[model samples]
Target: MTYFVTLEGETYEEARESFSWDVPDGFNAAVDLVRKHDDGDRVALHQAFPDGRRERYSFDDLDRRSSAVANALESLGLAFGDRVAVVVPQKPANVLTHLACWKLGAVSLPLSVLFGTDALRYRLTDSEARIAVVDVSQWETIREVAPDCPDLEAVLVVDGEPEIEGGTVGDASVSRFETAIDWRDDDHEVAETDVDTPAIVMYTSGSTGKPKGVLHTHGVWLGHCPAFSMYFERDLEGTYWTPADWAWIGALGDLVFPAWHYGQPVVGFPMGSFDPETAFELLAEFDVTGSFLPPTAIRMLMDVDDPADRYELSLRAICSGGEPLTPEILEWAEAELEGTVVNELYGQTEANLLVTNCREWFPAKAGSMGKPVPGHEVAVLDPETGERVGAGEVGEIAVRRDDDPVVFAEYWNDPEKTAAATLERGDGDGQRTGVRSESDGMPEGQAWHLTGDLAERDAEGYLWFKSRDDDLIITSGYRVGPREVEEAILEHPSVAQVGVVGVADDRRGKIIKAVVQPAAGTAGSEELREEIRELVRDRLADYEYPRAIEFREELPQTTTGKIRRSELE
Candidate 1:
């Protein structure tokens, strides 16, 4: 429960030398985040609903409720390694659902609450989720979507009205959250899983134009410890809050679970959407001290005139990522936030929090991505030969995968894609969890996981991000796969060819733009454009729909018929 990393000297190098990653052979995320911290009176979460309702949940409440959920899932025939879809937002039910899954040794597959029917169907089908725990808003849609998901046997609806009776919805059984767990015993036996066991399967946009699942092991939490403490400079004893959705690794791994692991309270507001004014109110109201705010969110906050004077705040540390923090944003935050420091953190869904800034220990270079986080090795590697590039030379950012607990187990079941991004192994340093074994699904080879992000390392070891090497789009901190959007647009019969690109924006870091070539002899019209926009919004996510759509006579493509996104950009 103590701070994961220790800081003895006033230097990043000294901090790195002083820290070590220690995880026991027998591990379970439920034990670490909830059960072990179950002191009946200590507050674990402070939740606020938009309806003016507020409540505090103790660790005791969480342990009992999560155990009851575990028992309920077992009664429904859930077994070890079964995937359960958690499609709720910041509600206590969302966290409880994850804890319940880990306790039963089931994998938690989280999907954004903003996803539409098409987005929901893909993840549920690909993960083969046996049950989906969703908010009431999705109940009507899930009723229509469940028949297409073969493994879906039940839907547990949260926050549903009494009239929304629990019964058979299509072929899947429907049950109310309270009705299912209220009578179950809170002493269900927790599965004794290991550090390497599969825990979370988070879907992310990939270069191949599909949303691939990034499977992280139970050790993933331990892998994030060093960076979490470092990012905040060990200033995490107080309450934590983040506007980031709990489904994101930046929120779940960086803030929520880590805060609980340290026996600290986390404030939860299902804000429904982000409003800078509302965010300030919640931050001041709860006395939150730590958070993981994305740079794009920070930009939105900057537009609020004088936040420090307008609201009483207690933020000691704020970690930012997704896009580089511009100098103007950093300067504004430094002067306005008083004591809080906005540190840039680097990592993707596959290997997160690997690079960070601890301004309390060492001065960070302006416009630099800080330094490699302690306990994790980061380097600029030549993409072709997999050799370390010299200083000041641009190369792909990569992290050693050999026994690195932060490296994902695999891209769900796509071993071919996994092998493509991984570099051949080098000798083991034995720092991360343990040595890689074929039993671990990967052998000793493929030691480096190529991030596909271009960057350069300075002589002082600070990394400067260059650009993304693929067609993926990061808009307002959400990673959107251009391919996913294009595929959705292609589903429309009027669209013959499509190209999706991310254009720079002042407010959102990037905005999605789709260029379309109408089907043979089909002329594009305003009605067709509106219809296409509606199709994307219905099939993908509301946040992922193209902001601008253009009708083109032809789209530039490679010889293989792949849309040339570079030309579109």
Candidate 2:
């Protein structure tokens, strides 16, 4: 029950050395962690609705309700290893469904509520989700895509009765969340599963190509403890909240799971979309102590003048990820939210947060992506030679396979892609190597997992993110990352936001193009564009400046707030 272990040591080095983790062979997260350590009568989930309504669920309540859900699934004939798609907003039902899946040893796939019919169909078919536990509003999209997903057995609608056309969902059955758990027994036993057992399958946006299902095992849950503990400074009785949807790892892995794993209560607000005013009201109303805010959301909040004067915020530390946290945004947040440190964190769905600006341990670095998290070996490597790059040299970000447990098992059912993701030690140099496996313990040499993202390490050992590997721009035999250009252009007072991309050119092979969204009161003019270009030219090399600038009211962005550079390209 006392899973909340406080990390000791005054310096980051001492903390990293003192950190330790030991997870049992067969670990059932819901049963072993939540149920075993029940902080009786304490609020485990505090949810706020957009209509000014609120609800609370205790730790014991979630445990029992989740068991009821597990029993209900069993009654409906769903068994272990089955895929259950969860497509709902941040609600008590979302946590209930995930815990139920864990109890039944089923694989849970969380799909974003903002996803379109096509995106929904792609995931449902790709992950082969058998049962979809979705919101009533999203039922129509599921109905349309049900015919394409042959494995879809039924759709469990939450928040309302299932209004199926002719009372049927094609061959797939339809049921309500309340009805499913109404008569079901609230005492389902946690299924026996090993640490390596498949627990969840999350899909990437696949902006580059078809979405790939990233699978993580039950054991990876252990890795989040020390990683999040070091970053968020897990407080047992403190209130926590995340504005991100339950679908993304930023919300699920970084906040929800970690909070539950470390015996901390979390606030869930299903506002549907981001709203600065509502966010301020909820945080102050709930007295939230800590949170993780993405860069995109931070940008929107920056517009709110003097946030501290508007509401009293209880935030001690704030973490950001997903996109780069510009210095402007950081400075604004720290100033607006008094006494709060807006620290930036770095990681992907493939592996959870690998690097972070641990504000509790070290001061915040404005634009740097901090140092590699303890237990995970992260480095910027030369892609061709698989050699570690020197300071200030841009290279592919790779995680060294050394006693690290957070690395994913495989890209669900794609062995070709799995092998491609791994780099053999000195294989490119034609060196003979023996067969070494992850199961046989840590093997020596330069073997690593390719992250496919480009970054450079500064002299301080802090990694500075650049751009995606495929997104790299090469013009006239010179290399350029859109981030550097975008950062420079963003420095202009008239420029509000910008997305840079490489466009096809007959002469230079590829030319740098800047898509900018000007600030209010500032018009997109040739004169203003020239001024922006002049700012960039003075800051960066002449060739690195954007050759062309296109102004828009807003840049194309995904639901998660990442800019869609592919659309611009």
Candidate 3:
């Protein structure tokens, strides 16, 4: 077997002790991982379209097609370090774009196809991308925004041309993807890049502030080998799928990169509006063995009646991320979806998945984020003093950087923000510690990466998520996280989804406010509000319960499906 990381022992403790990422510099995704592990004849991607169309691409097909794309891009005058912004959906072209970028040492920036013209323009301008690869259906957005993005030099349509006038971006050229790669050779020399060379730049959704570009390097891709092995039980013989856009890091990092690195085929679909029935059909039809869905998607599926009896699911492992998973959803999944526990994964766009409740290694508890995966040192620290907090104490969740080979290189061109996010050891000044011998395997550093999220560690070492540091609620003298209150309210039989925020109050400083979307056929009333408040009070502390509840049919969300809590205020 090709050398890939795997569990070496029976328990989580032993697995952690054995885990290591012996990553080296000059790692190229196209040459190092894919070309090395992929057997030419095996399927690499299986794309199932909604209109009853399906296509499969073997590893050899991707290798040749991506090389053609690289040659085509180079012919267009694109060079190393050039940013190629891609606004395509979950099609095969999307995967090809990333692989082609790696071959040229160019940085690929994936923008959500759901982003509006304004959002699209902001990212294009911020990243200063020279070229854009977009779908024909979304050409209007590009045309409207391209005029404002002076840095964008050309546009490459994925399938065909759109019915629009030309000269959109100051005479910027437009061509179809198929036409560009038509005559190109099926092979190109992969660029030799150092571990620190920027490979990709992903932007935050700007739920709080202006979107910031998170830059990652080629070596970080190598780190995913151990991160996946420690937290995920890979089934080389099984199919993989994630119900998220390839633009999101969750799908790209969790599903695409690691799966291909270990030589496994992945399922892809153009995500329009998500329908539970269609999702069920795909899972059954494909006989998917491993998959992941967001918490919101799971909540919607739970409303479907008798899913277990309706569909024959072949799922062996189920996982979730993007938000905390509620106990109610987990119970439903275990009962209806092949008796598999939904593992809750935790991480940010800056740092891929750092923690998980990996069922293969450890048993899970309700509402906990589980332990830090091997190769990461995660702890709760005092935000003020930067000291490690004791059990049951609430503080910022941080990861020590010394041992992490995958921590992001930097926030794109923002040194001050990067410095602010880095944490010092204890109360001491941030400085370099002496390098440890290879036997210890620790890097030379005295700083930790502050995650900017609040959490607490239990006596058993499980980490309970609280809220984003800015999202912490301060009512009177007590601090509360909205997730804790939201989790309790979601357990109500009448609630479908909930978002908790801190509303201004003169006496208490800030009062707990719950904005809820009631379950179908359930009417929202004062009586139901009181019942939810009572439920929270019983499940959590008295002060933690919401003082006010406002009902809504649906909450505003970003393109990636995270709730827009700031907009609610």
What does candidate 1's lDDT look like per residue over 387-504, in tens digits? 6688888778888776778889899889987877776544544322222222222334557788887778988888877656565578999877675577677768677677889999
Per-residue lDDT of 88-166 in model 3, one digit per residue for the tens?
9889889888899999999999998888888998899989999999987778888789888888888888776444323
lDDT of 3 at 155: 87
Clashes of 1: 0
Off by over 4 Å in 2: 1-6, 162-166, 233-237, 401-403, 426-447
Every model's TM-score = 0.80, 0.94, 0.94
- For residues 1-569, what per-residue lDDT tens digits would candidate 2 score against the true structure? 24443456877787678765555556777865468665656777888888888898877888888999888877777899999999999988888888899899999999988888999998998888888889887978887888888988878888865454224465688888777676346788789886678888988766556678998887666665566765665343577888998997778887788777666788898887789888888789888887888776777788888889989888777788766677887777667888677777787778878888776677767778788877677878676655677898998988865445567878988988877778665324332122232321234464667888889998877888888888889999998988878888878888878899999999999999999999878889999989988888898888988898899998887666678888886
Superposed on all Cα atoms, model 2 deviates from the true structure by an RMSD in Å of 3.0
The segments of candidate 1 whose C-alpha lies over 4 angstroms from its true place after superposition are: 1-10, 38-40, 206-208, 426-446, 471-569
Itemize residue pairs with steric clashes in candidate 2: none
lDDT of 1 at 204: 75
